[model samples]
Target: MSLLTVKNISLAFGGPLLLDGAELTIRDGERLCLLGRNGAGKTTLMRVLNGDLPPDGGDIMRRQGLRTALVTQDVPADLEGTVFPIIASGLGEQAALLEEFHQVSRSLQSSTDPALMERLAQLQKRIEETGGWQMQQLVEQVIRHLKLEGDAAFAHLSGGVKRRVMLGRALVSDPDLLLLDEPTNHLDLETIAWLEDFLVRRDKALMFVTHDRSFLRRVATRIVELDRGRLSSWQCDYDTYVQRREEQLEAEEKQAAEFDKKLVQEEKWIRQGIKARRTRNMGRVRALRQMREERRARRERSGTADLAVQQGERSGRRVIEAEHISYAWTGQPIIRDFSTTILRGDKIGIIGPNGSGKTTLLQLLLGRLKPDEGRVKLGTNLEIAYFDQHRGQLDEDRSVQDNIAEGNDWVEINGQRKHVIGYLRDFLFPPERARSPVRTLSGGERNRLLLAKLFTRPANLLVLDEPTNDLDLETLELLEGLLVDFPGTVLLVSHDRAFLDNVVTSTLVLEGEGRVGEYVGGYEDWQRQRAEQIEDEEKKPQAAAEKVQPQRPGRDRPRKLGFKEKRELEALPARIEELEAEQATIHEQMANPDFYRDHGDEVAQLQQRLEQIARELEQGYARWEELEALEG
Candidate 1:
């Protein structure tokens, strides 16, 4: 059933036109991933659906009594109070009912008034109707899952923590429709995986904006891509969506002479998708418009930026060597007895849950922090370029060009002097945008600018922390291409599964409690190996138990059975066959993609139950063998 319909939605912010007669129908149980380049107005469109921003011309119709919750990209500074109360407020009606119910109960306890009893009864009825307890329980679960500090003030929390809180609020609301902008932003790999499982299990309609390709593959049932003030819907996963889009574009190109208008439309959408990530707020729309000419000029002049990272003087074969490194802060050890060797041209990706000391390890390697025990040796002629998640090197007060130039008229690229504007263009920043304050640029644009700065300086080692954050799919691909092509050694910490798979040669996994291990291959391969390790560990105890168990006399043969047991065992083979057939059906269902996507939780339960059934079937066969021996 369709929960919300957006018809003829035309919105323009007096700058670039967005959502030109766009039409979207959101159905129940649909997990739609919204994708687009920066400045493509994806956020604006989401705001329209959220009723936070009304379209210039359109109609948003929702089913009667349909509830909706939105998690915005930026956490509002004005949202005061502690995290717990703020999140509890998202429960809406149920929150009020719960409070009223508690108040009425208190009143009845204090005085035996009949009126109090009546009020308490009414509140109780409403609470049960709204599932007030369930709503409260969900809120608590969300908080715990997101690792929120319940007592922390909203303003005092970090940006990432604040974003998590907002996400928790929206999820806990238990709305019919949930809209999230950059839902995966500021989340670690563990949290992202947890959220993927959470979304897969929930039947609620979800529309989330994310650049995480793996996330889209796991969670999205449909994709609504916003481009060139239009929306294109695809009922498929991320990979299929890209394949279909490419094939369509290829066919359009082949028939371009006859369908020039159609070709133009396709190209416009492609051009819109090339820009990368969205700005921090919609207010920057005018500034974005100023770059339109630059965008056009660049298209007319050349294709995408040639991001050739200039390698500095060659470092020794050993780029970095750590000897028995141990670090502790206030009696709590973050990294203990960790040792690693980084050779020249080696690309390593660091991954772990949030607060797993990935960043601290990077800092320690760079000599920013001294280890309590052991030493880190840097190779000769090593010049390291670090890209932090916070983009701390960027000066918000400085113009983009100034930030890049750093008071110089030009930058040296490959030992050649390049004009600041030309260099900025290489990072997808237009000449006009170069003059805009760094703070005014979108997160994606700022990240690009940061990359631009990093590449200008010659480096033998590159250290990137969450570099994929705020980057669009296209830019992410470009980054991966650059990393793959770069001669320098790379030590990267990113939650992007696809990006890590494409770029890194090895992975460093930081398991909490001071455990670290290295694995060959990317995130996916590492995860597979880890899962196998866990399975092996689980089987060890069972294997040991079976091996150490006492054996009865004549165990090699079968044990004797009484007459009643013999009759029961006679039916065991047929029962075992029935279970095997049932298991086959469940396996078939699990193998079906649609079944798993639609009923993830049920499928998981079925898998567990199937194992139990298999064991039971095996036991039945064993009993039947014993009974057959008695007949013999």
Candidate 2:
């Protein structure tokens, strides 16, 4: 059944019509993905559907009393309290019911008066009516799935963690419709895979905007695109959507070309002959005029930007070398005894989980951070241009031109002076937009500005940290092309699987331990190798254990273990279970609103301890698996 219907939705801003009579029907259990170039009406349309924005003209018909939740892109920076309280607030009515029930229970515990008994009974009835217990269970599940620390301060978490908390809040609501904006943007590959599985098992409808191709293929059941002020739908997977959209665009272009040719021929015939104005030729003239009007009114798709990066002076064969480098934060090791020599023209990708120190390693290599133990040496004549993920260098109050020129009207590119506006045009910023403040630009535009600034410096080594964050597909493609064609050494830290696959030749992996390993391909290639390696390890261990089977088939002998090994073998499982129980207790404490409200200051400390326990639990599980293999 269709859950919502949008009819003749018309919206416009100051510059142009964003959505021209757009219409859509969102059905139940549909996993829809919205796609388009940056600055299209995708987010705007989502806001309208989520009831945050009203279209200039439209009729939105939704199921009566349908619950919907939108996980917006912007994190609530001003939101107070710990993660638990923030997410619990999304429970809406159920939260109220639970709070009232708790209050009644507290009162009843102190006084067994007749009035208290009546209030407690009413509160219990309301809690049952609203399914408060079930809602609480769902909220806990979301929090655990996302690995969010309920007691952690919402404002202190990283951008990625903040995004995860927001996602958890929306999921806990158990809404009929879920609206997600770039849900997978800041998540690691593992978290993305988990979310894909989570959404796949869900029956509720989902509509999200993301540029992650692999995620789209795995999560989207239907694909919709906002193009040329209209919405186009494809009831297919990511691969099929791409193929069909290209075919449709090709057909349209051919049809328009044919019409244009015929109209030109008719116009020539009417002009070349004096009798063309007669009654017989009137029909041909009218058709020609109609074709002209149609062509003029049609809004063609915008052209792709030309992103060209010229090669700088060649450096020595070795671009960068880390000789036994080690870095630690407060005695917690991030990188230890790691050594890698980056050669000229090498495109290496750095990947791992969120806190694996990929960005830290990049800084260490680029001379931004001094190593704690070993030396980081650069090649002769080495010039580095680093693109920081935070975009801290850009001034939001300044104009695009001012930023690019850095208080000057001209920027030197390869020893030649170029006007700032002319250089900005290369990155798709027109003359008018160049004068606008950086704050007004979209994410993609800001990314483009970063690129523009990076190129003006002329460096042989390019270091990018999460460069694909705010970039659209077109700009990503352009950046990929530029990287492929550039004659320089590149080191990148990105979470984008497809982008990494297309650009990088090798990868450096950090597993959040003090170890860094090398892989000879992109993210997918690394995953494949890792899976095969694990399989091989499992098979070898099993085969070895089978070879050491009891000498006599009829005699069953108990396996003997040394004192240390025996104690470890006996205590590991119990320890694992104890850790798990502790985690559950922490989660329960955090999920309770009353507890969180009363102990907000203790939340951060508890979260830190919880994180430590989680790490230990993971290590313990791995050790348990190894012990089991040995016992076998």
Candidate 3:
């Protein structure tokens, strides 16, 4: 059955029509992805779905009994409330009524009137029948699956954590209709994986508004695009959507071009006719007039060029190297004995779970950190620029042009003291938006401004952290093209798997605790490895068990330890201690700035690896320790 239907929905903000004649339908178990450039009315459409924004001219049909919810990035930053109350929003009116019903039922059960007792029993049964007892567990599962496993206060949590809390809130009630607005924006890779798995088993219809390509591919069964206030739907996944959308745009462009050419030709011929051509050729003139009328009726679809990032000459043969580096935060070591080497034009992507020190490693490479125990080295003439996730370099109070202008004190084009307006124009910023403060710009705009700043720098090696945030699809495509053609090297920390696939030739993944792994190829190669691992496990379940845990299965009796097991247990403690020491050393090295100038990037990378190895070593040790201390 159709869960909800929207027809001819239209909404206007000030003078600009955010949505016009947008139509969409959500069916039972349907998964749809809403795609468009930033400010293209996706969020507004979601609001229309929830009936929160009554369209200026439209009607909606919904199931007689169904609930809906939206999860957006505005997950109140200064959340003073408990996580329990946050998740309760998904319950909608049922939660409120449930509470009121429970209180009234309790009061009724205590009354002497026989009618009251019967009514109380009926209400109690209804509440229990509605899965009241199971609801809390559902909420907890949502909480855990989204990976918000900590009890820290909301203010202390990162934006990503709070976003997960909001996600949990949205999923707790299992509403008939779900609207997810950029759910994966701030989530870590681990959480994203968990979400992908969770969404696969979801029964409720889902309408996801997101720019994350991987998330769309994993979760969406259909794609809908909002163009010029009109919504069009496609029956396909993200890859298929890409092809279809491109074809549609190409066809539309061709039609518009042909119509325009014919209109020009008609006008030219009409002008050329003059008095020499006569009323005798009246039919031809009439034909030209009809052609102009047809041309006027034809719709024109226009596309703007995405931003362009130019890469300057390579700095040196050896761009960056790190040696025996170590770093720690609040006594928790992140990098240990890490070493890595970067060649000219190497587009390296650093990825891992959150708190894996991906950002810290970037800082160390860019000479922002002083390794406690080792040194980081850079090649002579190597210039580096860093783009942090928060856009730390950009002045929030200043204009977008001010930020870019600060990169170089001089002007670039014609040396006319390039104003902030000129720089912003090159970035596709309109004249009205040029003077706007950085705080007023949308996510995509800010990201564009950041890119503009990066391109204007003297750096040959760019280290970008979470550069995909708030960026539109157009800009991402531009970035991918730029990276592919860039002459200089790039070292990046990004969670966008698709972006990594397109732009990165090599990968350095930092698994928390101080270990980092290097892989060649992009996301496809990584997925293949994971698939092989799964296949191998299926082929040898017993072996896999032995590799990960005890080999015993379906056994009530515990097996006695063999000599090999005993030796393994005995060596584990000492091994764990060695790793702990190594982790400490790597953290110290990552903290030192001299490491960048004195050693190779390989040294810094080795320190990163040591950090990861230390983590694995600890896990192994802990497992062995458990084996040795078994009560069995």
Task: Identify the candidate with maximal lDDT.
Answer: 2
Superposed Cα deviation of residue 456, candidate 3 (Å): 1.5
Task: Report lDDT (Cα) of residue 241, candidate 1.
Answer: 83
How many residue pairs in model 3 have overlapping backbones?
A: 55
Candidate 3, position 452, lDDT: 81
* Global Cα lDDT for candidate 3: 0.72
| TM-score of each predicted structure versus truth | 0.75, 0.80, 0.73
- Cα deviation at 288, candidate 3, in Å, is 8.8
Q: Candidate 1's residue-wise lDDT over 35-110, tens digit each?
A: 8876678888878887789889878998999888888767787899777767887887676675565455445444
lDDT measured at residue 245 in model 2 versus the true structure, 0 to 100: 82
Clashing pairs in 2: none
Task: Give the count of colliding residue pairs in each prediction.
Answer: 2, 0, 55
lDDT of 2 by residue, 1-632 (tens): 98999998989998678888898999999999998887887889898999999989979999998889998777776877677656777898777665555455545444545554555455545655676655755665567667787668888898778888888888777789999988877787777887887889899999998878778788899988998779988988887777888899899999988988987887677777556455456667787788889888788887677776545789999988999999999898999999999999999999988777888888888778999999998889887888878888899999999988878988887777788888888788879999999999887788889888888887898999988876777778789999988899999998889989999999999976689988899998898777555545544545566674423222233333434555698899999999989977875675555554455455546655665777687679768876677677
Model 3 C-alpha lDDT per residue in residues 1-632, reported as the tens digit of each score:
89988888778978567777778888999999888877677887888788778888888999998888887656665567556556655776546534444444345433444444444345435645676535644554566556665234666667777887878877876878889888888777777877887787898899888767888788888888888788899997777777888898889888878878887876777776556466436787898889888776553332453454444555878888888888888888888888888889899988888767888888888788887778899887876767778877779898666667754444453224556566667677866776678998777778788888776656678788888876767767778887788778888787788999999988887766787767787766766655454444543654454675534232344434544456678787888788778765764553354443344334425533653674476468548856766525
Ranking by lDDT: 2, 1, 3
- Which is the winner by lDDT between candidate 1 and candidate 3? 1
The TM-score obtained by model 2 is 0.80
The alpha-carbon deviation from the true structure for residue 306 of candidate 1, after best TM-score superposition, in angstroms, is: 3.6
